[model samples]
Target: MKKLYILGIMSVVCVFFGSCNDEWKEELHSQMISFKAPVGSNGVCDIYMRYQPDGTASYELPVIVSGTRDNGRNINVKIGVDNDTLYHLNTEKFAVGRKDLWYRQLPENFYTFPSEVCQIPAGENVQNYTLNFNLKGLDLNEKWVLPLNVEEDPSYVRNIRKGWCKALLGINLYNDYSGTYSTTLMNIYVDGTTNDPAIVDNRVTRVVDNNSIFFYAGSVWEEDENRSKYKVIVTFNEGELNKDGNMAGSLTIKQGDPTSGANIVPVGDCTYELIVQKHETKPYLERHITILRLEYKYTDFTSDPKNPIIYDVKGSMTMERQINTLIPDQDQAIQW
Candidate 1:
């Protein structure tokens, strides 16, 4: 595959939040290898080999290279496959913890190198690693990956952070998942009790690509003092859908009352995608979501710094939407 990022001016990604700390910020500039692009807005680096254009079975992923400079010149680096760091960073950077991750393999033939030695040119800050895989060797109906970490070199440095120096390659090819699915969010109490879904169950499409979909969850505010808008973000990335044909992905719930979507927390082991008929038309909806129903109780920290609260989330939701719910702008359509 060819390079995707523009040269000489690679863009810096979004600031790592909630999990953001001075130590992490310092580590960002520290000697290490990291991805060049932000993992969409939801903080997930998901690339869907959803389809092959022009009979290509290769995917290009750009990576950032930085390390100690010996004397005046920065050290030239090589990011080879490192089997040592066999774990996801599971940090605030990816907005996901280790427990929430699903790992897979893209078979042995799919190698993570553009050549025998993937090198970062001397004085260059970026290098694109092209994943060469045989599509015919992969099962389109199942999910897979090309998991990697910064293979340690004797001369250069690598980020020792939990989430850094790692890449989870979710490789698959299918693009039928594009639409506004109707949804129902059941807010449960800490006691693990449920209630009727009060908020409107619907999702509006924000952006759609060949292999992924980004959409805002339908939200409503409750009165604590004044009405504030809460937000839910659902992202379906490449190879995210699992073997059971369930839409396996991540969700971010935000309360605007205090932080205006800044106070976000990801619920563990939540929703799944199901296909059903709606008004004589069939569409895939992210319904049948049962939250906090896991055997192991999970706890997470809130965004509060001074008086941070450690809390547990137990909720269920049902999301359903029709394909091509894209509201084409009338003006633009007329222009076309």
Candidate 2:
């Protein structure tokens, strides 16, 4: 009986050790690798790969090139099975070019190869891959490296426009009644220095009724005040015209705020109300009345310093046609 007990204990120890070995083997079968670029500059090339215990693998390749003062940047990336000869399996190409020198802008013109998957070699429990790339004339000396042992989460980076203000004003006549009317101009005030402060000022303007109604809008950076503001002014004119005509207006909108630096505040959603009054010179007429309500909404807002600040403004107008009892003949003239 004692000999049988000894044999049983030996068998239990063997089974426990075998189970631990199997777990170790499974852990060793999986592998991962991560890559990072040097400091003070964007990454020119980086690659990531993961190997599973089931002989499957995945990879992500990222490439970036530096832009120059005069020309654009180029990026190239390639990945392939790890062999003595370093044969490439796939490649991705992307480029970023400079569009405007005054804006100091670099726009991304290409992007490809988000991810890929493949199977490991048959009968071979281990798998490995190679990454090769060239960035903006810079040669990467590192040819191949083991993938990071930790799993990496998917990531994405993009550039979006922000901090822009757009405003629109439209007036629709209900009936065919011809009369002279003046346009109201908008005034913009901007505080703080910017790469192009004048660029912000030119965004606001008079869009409709160029001959009948005058529009004025501009931005200015005030160093002393340390604040940036945009203003739109609408001026209206009174005159006589042949009765029977309707007018509709529209215009292009652009950025009216500073792109960078301190005191750069984004213009939030806003709306303005305009009041129009009619009066006859022979009869005294004066009253403040609401004529139109203009609402502006900016959908895209970004903190990125490279993009321009632009907003979308939609305008709507409401007119009152009630006759004025105070003035005799026709009706009272419009008042402010």
Q: Report the number of the highest-lDDT candidate.
A: 1
State the displacement of the C-alpha of residue 207, model 2, in Å, after optimal TM-score superposition.
Answer: 45
**Tens digit of per-residue lDDT, candidate 1, span 127-199:** 6776776555443323355666666677666665645666666554433443334444433233354444234
Clashes of 1: 11
lDDT of each: 0.43, 0.26
TM-score per prediction, in order, is 0.37, 0.18
Off by over 4 Å in 2: 28-106, 110-336
**Distance (Å) between predicted and true CA of 33, model 2?**
6.9
Worst 10 residues of 2 by lDDT: 163-172
The per-prediction CA RMSD against the true structure, in angstroms, equals 20.5, 27.5
